[model samples]
Target chain A: MGKHTVVPFGPQHPVLPEPIHLDLELDDEKVVRAIPSIGYIHRGLEKLVEKREFKEYVFIAERICGICAFGHGWGYCKSVEGLMNIEIPLRAKYLRTIWHELSRIHSHLLWLGLMADGMGFESLFMHSWRLREKVLDIFEKTTGGRVIFSACKIGGVRRDIEDSELHGIAEILRGMRDEVREITDIFFKEPTSVSRLKDVGILSKEAAVATCAVGPMVRASGIPLDYRVADTSGVYRELNFTPVTTDTCDCYGRCWVRVQEIFASLDMICQAIEKIPAGDIAVPVKGNPNGEYFARLEQPRGEAFYYVKGNNTTHLTRFRVRTPTNMNLPAMVEALKGCDYADVPMIVLTIDPCISCTER
Target chain B: MGYLSFAGTILGGLFKKPVTTQYPLKPAVLPEELRGRVLIDIQRCISCGMCMRKCPAGAIVVDRSAKSWSINRFACVQCATCVDNCPVKCLRMEPQYAAPGTVKQNETFVKQAAAQPAVAVTLVKGVTPTASAPATGTQAAAASAATAAKTAAAPQTTPPGDGAGHA
Candidate 1:
């Protein structure tokens, strides 16, 4: 056996978009064990609920992670609404689904770009991000903000997308499909790309279930668990969404699952726009919420958990978010073991860690 | 050998124009939903201070005495809560974003009425100017008692004339 050497990967690294430190125990060039230490970017966002009113806390929630901003805001509002027993209008639920699906597409595309960049495919990264800009343009034309769509409120949505605008969005997505498929086909079919990821970081179905992985991470491992498929909140069930899964349980499988899910998200958005019922976007939400409620949603990363406790006051007593990245950390550490040093970034990127969301 | 599959796309790109635009030289088209900056029409402002109160970032300051509204552009999050809550639709969100600057931009908009000559100000208590004598002690006491009784008897709805003082 070779002598072991320890190396600290990052509190800062080029491949990592957020700050996280990992200590890798290496025997020669293979990582025998990996230890992760977080909390570098913790901003105490959960504690801010004591100061900011519940209505305004949605803004803080949205700021949790730029990629999953809409999902965070919607999850927070859903928790508060559950606490207050407020049933939003049907149209608002449909609109929330449309925006949420759009956010999912953008986030997966962004991850695909970052993954390609991590694997030294700069041209693929550029193409992926270029296509992502069209989705951002759709967000701008509908919700006013590319990253933070301040549309979700406690009772319902803040604004409504007109039927004509919804059709315009569908046309844009349909037009972009061929380009997206062309770019992503390179990832799936290119021998070099497939070789780098095909068997790099294998997380078996048992290992994934044991680690309680969520999102594409678990789906790639052959478990058909998806928060959206089992969701009780929102109109995801009514829209007839299906979870994309594969049994390969490798880095490449994770990438494939995400790309397939992007197409699924596009179909869901088109379906939501088609079946959208016309009604008031929002009803007046009066009175302070008083109760404890736990809300969970399928974020682009995974299943995000939000718990809110209001004490009949404007300020919430406690607000907590269990981001998907946080839940997938154990799975990440498991996947990191027995991998070459060069594959570290690829394995980490497959998990799609949002350090800000986890630390916040 | 895997690179051969991408040859078609590479050749296609050779004929197509570059995707990126010369942003600095050519202005980009902005969407209507863009939340760029907050602007207020000073003429339509009622000095009610609702925008100041509702702002999550506390980036706005409304000084009724000065007849001025000011905002620190950098501090504004462009959430549009102020615009939605404004009693009159005077506040608007301009689609064009504020130009990036090294220095903080503080914009103070003065009401047109502020430039006019000083006139007799009306107080909610019906106080008026008297050159020779101030309000007599008896008259002040009577007015105070009447107001106190009216407040005690009524449910104390928001007074119409009281502006920033009550807030």
Candidate 2:
């Protein structure tokens, strides 16, 4: 047995895009335990709901996390809309679902690039991001903003994608499918990546459920727990959405799930475009929302929960967001146990931790 | 799983042109739908303050008494809520972003009193400009101008608390 050494890992690290600090207890280069300390980037976004009107708080919600901006906004709107008993038009739901799927593809690509970068594969990282740029271009062309798309409003979507434009977006995604497959194939087939990922950071199904893991983390552990399956708010049911799962229960499995999700999201977007009904995008919301509702959404990373309480006023009484990263932290810490100290970054990245979302 | 599995991609990438543009050297491509900066047509502004009321960032200030609208570009989140809520359709989202500045300053657009006669004519045609209560259009316009001059002469006061004062 070696002497224990405590190594403080971040708030700043090369591999981490967001600031998150972790104290790793190491015994001769093996991590005995990883103690995560968050709250580095909390913006108190939920508190702003009191200041901004219920209608306007969607903008604040959208800013919670840049990568999951659309989901956050949609979740907030869904909660408020539910509170107000407003039923949005069918076309609006379809449009929102399409944008959500598009964002999922972009987000997964971004994670793949970051994962490659974390694995010290610079070229693969660049290639992954290069593919991601096309998705951002699609976002810019359709929703205006690449990262912070304010297309979602309280009652419904702010802008409508013309049927032809929707078809064009679908065609663009289809065209990129081969290229995406080519890039993602390297993650699976490349000897170095396989060695780095496979059999590393193993989180058993029991441990995953015990730690309350969400999103790909749970899916990677052979659990088909996807909020999209249960969520009635979006058109996921209409599209016949199914959660992607794998039994590997390691870093590789997480990667595999995310990569598969990229393709699944693409297919879902195309399906939505084909089946989208033509109708009014939004109906006028007349009065203030006066109730409390909890809205759950399937973000690219995981399941996000939004709780909103409105007291018959323009301002909401309380707004709370439970991001997927927050739920996955315990599972992440559990996975980190007995991991090589060198593999800590990889293990942490496997959770796709968005500290901003968690802290917000 | 071969060690050189990526070698083919590497060699092919060398032959291919770089996917990224030179950006500044190549004047980056911008989409038409890009939400960049808020612009106001002062001539058409009714001083109704809808933009100010709707701006989530509290970046806009509409002074009805002064017949002026001002936006702090640094504070604006570029959400285009103001553009959507503008009653007179005076607000627009220009694709060109405001140039970065060393100092934070408010860009003020004051409706020229000369343009008021046209607005006054529209107001008098029973259009019921939402800016103020019902009154004879000519007198109301003159009174607003007088108040504008009075407020302009006085030291500037801070705009009301975001959306709270209206309620």
Candidate 3:
């Protein structure tokens, strides 16, 4: 019998952008179990609702995760909007979708780069991130900030992109399709990439559903459960949104799903730009929001839920965000069991962990 | 699979220029819409304090008494809320980001007190009558001068003589 040993993995691992500690129980070279401990980066952001006015809370919400800043900002606004019953303009919805999809593309590209880096593929990581910079350029050109957009407001959006500029953005994304395809091809055809990813951290459909995993984690396991499809929120429905899922239930499948989703996001953005209506971008929202409302969004990692309760005052009574990584921790533990210790980072990267969002 | 899968892509990149440029030496061209640093046009500032109130980071400080506006660049989040909420449109966002510095930069914009009208002297005398107050003559004169300068620049609905009743 092999002696069991506990190995603590990362609050400051080179691959991780945010802090999250995991204690892995190992039987020789195989990981027997993984116990995750969160809260290293907890800033008590939810409690700030008591102090900051609901209008100003959007800015704080955007800070939850720099990668998914637009999504967090949009979700907070959506919750408050739902509570206040404020109907945003049609143009605002289209604009939000464009920015959100752009965010999705950048995030996926970032994950791909990080996954490559984690797998010791330096050139691939650099190539993927180089492509990602173009997406960030689009973001900076339209929304003003590469990471924290700050373009989202309570009732609607803060700025508007001209149709010509939107068309220009569409052209850039169209050009990106070939570059992304090239990188994706390398991941698929390269023996090194396949050897590292394939047959590692396999999660069955049954176990994934049981663990209540969300986003690409479950999607890669063959469950087509996408929050964008399930919730029917925002302009996703109007834009012919489609969820990309795979039946492999492995690390490679997860990578494939994310890459495909990036293409899907690009298509969605182009379609949104094509069908965007001409109208006011924002509506003046008056009075404090009353009652409680829940806003769910399909963030880059997965479905992020925001629950907001307001008391008819500037200050909110309660506000909370349940990020996808928080939901997938149990799934990560399940995936880690019986896997080679060397595959820990690959398996963890497959879930696209965003500790900042989780701990916030 | 072949011994080398990256060969084609690697060969293709051999002739292409590097994606990254020499930054700081030759300035990278920023997008027109890029939100970098906040700049204030002091001449157009009305001291409405909207920027200070709306700034989520609390980076802006507007001193009403001194008629000065200062922004701590490090604390500013570059959210542009201050620029958007500025009533007079005095605030603008420049595309050039503030250079990293050892010293924390605090940019203060002070609007020189507007030209005091000649009528301000007589109006100040009416507003503060020294007959009943313990204030010395010099103190009264200085206080009245400051008040007179403020009153002259600001819009008025009633004549300065209305304060004569209070005096």
Candidate 4:
């Protein structure tokens, strides 16, 4: 704490939507350290998973966080399916990929809106969120929830998206792309935004990869390990997947990567619409599974890993989740260093840290 | 060139529409079976204890075999695995995804009539009712079901006057 003033960025802040406490050590205007203190919104997901039966944990997993609900649910189901050696139906796999991309689009747009808010660009914030509503509309129509999509299940999805709506939903996503493109252009064109963001919380390519800064943050540093594209043998191959990448490895670079990703996700949704197969939504799974498996999925934020161990009983023995935000926290803590005090919020916003996921 | 792009940026703000849709009054059109809260069609439940066994939250309990299902609503996460596993097709996850009450838990889902028995052979992968089941003779099954129906219909008060004379 030598020659540094300690200031607390709280569990509730104007800039950050997720509640997190960070003790910032500032030397003049630059940040020397950002020691984050978490555990504010812990839903005790791990403890609850122990009490609930393995199959029933899907809802509990979905409730872990509002933003990453679909990914958490998907991770849980995949883990259970793997333990049982249940080969998921092709239709379910495809449907799952659809929801995952949809979740990514909505989550990124939401983050973009929040980032705009941090810059005091209230209009831009509203505009991005306006575009985000279309994604939410589609989500509610398909799975019946705007945020927490409990659509994913043990072997497959719970409900089927009507084949009739596929053509229309595809059209809706395409329309959203136009607005997203316009908004991204605005964010880039705005002098205040660019001046505030460009070269502001620089995490180099080597740093990003070594620290496992994932999702858009890693891509901004030019790392091309996107699970959707890498997991092509599963469902990504059927759909067109364009990995969003950038070279700047700065705040604007992260923003651009997310903007580019929205278009890629829209393209994926269109491809899924064309490739959607006809079949039952889910296969009934029975008996207590007697094995352990880890399911890794590409969530919007980053890699979401679910480790499930089932005894020869109805209840799951051990259920563990390695959320994306948890992996990014180290990088986030590092990214905050050497940033201007006034720009500290912008650096934090760039990570799009879903603290609920971290605490859960 | 910089000024030209800056000029275009200034004009863009005026055209954009406001995004906030008034909550509560405007009303969000939620999805069907969206997990706002748990709803049970109690009548369809066979009280087979399937929901209790499969509950991830351990929120549901059944009493009086195939007769009543009790659910502690407070603890329920509304996973709907119980709805999925019900052999009777009686237990259902209803469209009402939310409710508000001061009392957190409910001791009962409710007592309701059981749905028709599942006739089609369904393959359930994990849990109970293993891969094998009682073999079926299509025609014999129909005839035996009819006879069992007649036996169940027979009254207990047989020949009341004859029983009185004997006493």
Candidate 5:
């Protein structure tokens, strides 16, 4: 029998991009249990809905998480639009989908970089971020901001990409595909990386379903649960969206899912640009929204749900966001059980926790 | 299965130029569409208060009575909501960011009234021209001159507090 010792990890750690604390109960060099405590970066953005007008809250919603800013803004607007019964233009829908996919590419690249850094592969991390810079350049050219894009509005989008610019962006993304393939190849084929990732932390399909995991976490465990296929929002259905999955249910499987999803996102963006029709980008929204509606969106991390309740006024009565990281925390705790103490950070990184989004 | 699989990437990187720029020595390459900071054309502004009302951060204050507009640059989120909502098209977004400052201060812009044309001074014996003949053109000119003088004398007072702070 081994004596158990409780160890506190993070709120501030080199591998963590945002603040989250975990109490790890370790028996010698192996973790037996993990207890997570959040709320260090809570900004109370949901309560701001009562003070700011429903139309103005879109900007606030976009600031919830810098990585998934566009998705959060789109999700909030979709909820309010559903509440008001305002149908956006077809062109607007296609533009939103394109921007969302671009964000997904950048986000997955960022995650790959972080995962590499967590695995002690510094050069791979740098290469991943270097490829991601091209996507940020595209965002700056189209949406006016590199991080927090204030493009999504209540009724439609604020800006439109000309056909020539859209084609140019598609060309750039096509060129980026080869560079990304080169960087990701090392992760899959390199002995060092594969040794660290394969079968390190295993979360079985039943346990994943029990903890109610979302996004790549569940997909890696052979469950095809993705909001892009389940929900009819945006133009994903027209693009023939399919959830990427694997049966390994380990850290390497999660990495493979994210890498495959990045390629899938690039293809979806190209398809959308080809099929996009020229029309009005935004329509005039009239009157206040008066009802409650929930909007589901497939963020780069996973499924995010936005709930908005309006009371026939300029301001909404309630606004809530159920971020994917919040849903995956229980699954993370479950996965931490019986893992080597040295593999704790790598196991946590596989979930791709966005504490800012969760706490907001 | 190779341990040295990443060596080729390292060798290729040694020949390529560095990706990062010398930021402080050379100015950053800013995109044309970058939302940096808010700029206002005081001449074209109608003092309609649309920017003050629509600013989610509450960083702008339009004093219609004094014909002045003030914005706390530190409190602004640079969302360009003011630029989009401006009815008179006076507000715009400049790509250059605001210079960093040690202390917070409000940037106030007061519209200057155009110069008044010369008016002939007529004298009356029985009634005072200023008091009795209020409807005359000369009276209107005199009243405008007085108001313009008052506006010229008004000090550029900084708004009391940035409302609600940055969002």
Candidate 6:
């Protein structure tokens, strides 16, 4: 009778935290084309760049995303340093790498928990979140905040890690990996999990690339475009970059890529810490920045984009951020094609969407 | 291999303790140097505006004339800028983390830090607190004399809040 039955997906849909909505056009219980609607949690973070001082903008930038505060701080610092042509100390660079990888592991752990819950795998969800608590405990003990860790500042990180802390990190990671691998193995082996995920919400490489899908989403489609491996910023040069992907391009594939990334992050962290150099944490940056610059870094979900322009004043002129979730929304819609109505939330959860980062 | 794996899984299940603590009863201790609770040693506070100027959260109000400082527990972020630059060393950062309310406007976490008691021992030349005071005072000053070095190394004293004492 009707051309299609349209269903509103989210903003308060149990799947995501930050608000994001999708109108699904369904034909006989099958999603044909999904239309994504965003911008619910936009706080005008970019606008603050014009009002706050350059050095202090790091604080605002760190709030761009809560789960990955270190990533935000590192990205903003990298951007400002790029404009000033200032080279951070080797020790600072290694510390940033360690922090970034640790954040990635936590991000993936959080996603795994959510994904498990999304597919009705409650035990796995509890297991992952519980394991993630250890990481947060480490964060609180090492850097301070459990969520928005205000650890990274303008030039370097706020604190230094001692040998005992590094040992603690490596030991915990080793133990956590075993539990994570067990859950992952069970996820792939269970028939119910397979029935829900294996072939659902597929996005081919062509659609993925054209839609500018990023992070594990693109990798799931068989595109090897990881910013860490392709990165020449020298911060990630010493650490190995092994891109992981599966050809299924389905929810399972995306989930698998993220799972594999946890292992990759562990390896990177272990290496970065061993090669750490000792020096002054923060370098002396005399004055404010005066120029226009855009910087990009890989977030746990995908590629996070940052843009800042200075008017030679205490405050910046214009600042804009295009988060990875925003870039992948169109592709997420495409991925939902041919997916069953019941699996919509699972498909969305697999993307690990942080709509706050997206809308910011 | 299957039997061995199952056995290992069973063993793992029995040995691992639950990661989370019993909430509301079993409280945890946060680490030192943590930017958790905002402290203000009111007596040592010099009414200096360094903290007020640097606070990104605008949570501190220094009323020099009133000889008083107040902080809005609801507005602080615990960023620790006040503690870092307190020239009189009055503001101290500690590991007291607890938000008592809801909404960004309702997160009440206020505390009062009294003025630090300074021991009035006689000042000695060429003698300093070992492993404490850096050479910044010596090398930086010896390199450039003639300027009064009276308050050269006094840590700035800032009073209460992470910066959000609105009243």
Local accuracy of candidate 1 as per-residue lDDT tens digits, A1-360? 997999998989989989999999999999999999999999999988898888888888898899999999999999999999998999999998889889999999999999899989999999999999999999898889988889898889988899999999999998888899999999999999999999989999999999999999999999988888777667888876788999999999999999999998888888888899989998888999898999899998899999999899999999999999998999999999899999999998999999999999
What does candidate 2 score on TM? 0.89
Candidate scoring better on DockQ of 5 and 6: 5
- In model 1, where do residues sit more than 4 Å from their true spots? B1-18, B114-167
Encode model 2's per-residue lDDT on B1-167: one tens digit a residue: 69799999999999998876787888767888899998988977778888888989999998987889999999999999999988668888877888999999999999877533323223357564343333333333544344443334323332233223322
Model 5's CAPRI class? medium
Q: Give the per-residue lDDT digits (tens) of candidate 5, residues B1-167.
A: 59789888898899987768889788898988989899999866767789999999999999876779999999998899999999768899888888899999999999776455644444567853342222333222223444443334323321222221211
**Model 6 lDDT per residue over B1-167, tens place:** 75686898678878998656777678766677566777776655656567777787787777655546666666677777677777877877778764676554422222233323444444588886232333342122222231233223333312223133322
Model 2: residues with Cα > 4 Å off, grouped in runs:
B1-19, B115-167
Model 5 earns a TM-score of 0.88
Displacement of the residue A166 alpha carbon in candidate 5, Å: 0.4
Least well predicted 10-residue stretch by lDDT in candidate 6 chain A: A228-237
Interface RMSD of each: 1.0, 0.4, 0.9, 2.7, 0.6, 1.4
lDDT of 4: 0.78
Off by over 4 Å in 6: A1-3, A232-234, B1-20, B98-167
Best by DockQ: 2
What's the distance in Å from true for residue A213, model 2? 0.5
Candidate 4 stretches greater than 4 Å from native: A1-3, B1-45, B58-75, B103-167
Q: What would the DockQ be for model 5?
A: 0.64
Sorted by DockQ (best first), the order is: 2, 5, 3, 1, 6, 4
Question: How high is the lDDT of residue A71 in model 3?
Answer: 93
Pitting candidate 2 against candidate 6, the one with the higher TM-score is 2
Model 1 lDDT, full chain set: 0.87
The two-chain DockQ for each candidate, comma-separated, is 0.55, 0.71, 0.61, 0.34, 0.64, 0.36
Give the range where candidate 2 chain B is weakest over 10 consecutive residues by summed lDDT.
B158-167
